[model samples]
Target: MTEDMKMDTVVALLRDQPDPINVLYAVSLMGLTKGLWKVSGAGSAGVTRAFGEDIWRLIKIGSTLLKADQDTSNPQKAMEFYDSYLIGRFNVADSMDYDVTDDSIEITVKNCRAHHYTDYLEENDVPRSVGCPLALGCAAMMEEVTGDPFIVDSIESKDGNSKIVLKKF
Candidate 1:
């Protein structure tokens, strides 16, 4: 099929879905990650790490644009907002559980759409630690809410769930 026809077909298929925008978003992120890996001639881990770093740098703009009216200064409140944002606005995950501490946020993402890309990378021998969008998004949200730079301390996936730890510095 022609490219336009192919896109039209995909769109038509997605139109009946509950959250078509999320599917598109997930596909775009996967394409971008794959493209960056190919064009940069970088290892999968390197590509994903760089992608995460870029997300960290750029996410402030997204956080600002998506900011809610409530005060999220408290870490617990911030996490609550992040959870709602992930399920409601981002539409990237089925659910999320978070634990907030003095300087860290541990987030478990259930049924994240980006797990497909992470699995693809792993099938090609990439490490599971390769960052996923959900991980980066959580770290970014924490940094934005706390007004402190938060780094992805660790990320692991198993059985369609991803656990991410963001540590403030």
Candidate 2:
């Protein structure tokens, strides 16, 4: 089978599985992204960016399967829901705190997997930010939940923690 066909089959299978299984697979997929970053050399940033876009696309697909039930009209509630969703769905961080306002969302994540993954990339001479897929994931989910577009304004990481800021667009 071709690569596209193989990926389609895998995605179909994943979509059919339980949430816990899908979360495990999603975490494993991060290792694949790391390996891709290592080999892409100067194109590592593009590869990482593509991975982030793919994450958004994948979440869009998953959201269709599991529609959100909460009333996420409030900006604060939407941001809080996205925070819990990230932790529950992808195990991206050990814990997350959010500061949400009318036009912005600031999140501080502790023990973030994306930070550690980017640290590995940095060690390999690839200078990539710590929030590629994580930032995109948040933006995509927030947009889906709140019906408002968001852009990643900033991402900073230190000592296994990351602070990401997303602005409404």
- For each of the candidates, give the backbone clash count: 0, 0
Of candidate 1, the 10-residue stretch with the lowest lDDT total is 8-17
lDDT of candidate 2 over 1-169, digit per residue (tens)? 4556435534543554467765475546555655765676546555555555677666545555678444467777756666666677778779988887767778888987555445444444444353356776766656766687777787777756878898888
RMSD per model, one decimal: 6.8, 9.6
Clashing residue pairs for model 2: none
lDDT by residue (tens digit), candidate 1, 1-169: 3556435534543553457676677557656665665666435555565565565444444566867444467889867865666577666689999899759988888877566666654544444455476666556667666778776787788756888887996
Clashing pairs in 1: none
Candidate number of the best TM-score: 1
How high is each candidate's TM-score?
A: 0.62, 0.56
Candidate 2: residue 69 lDDT (0-100): 42
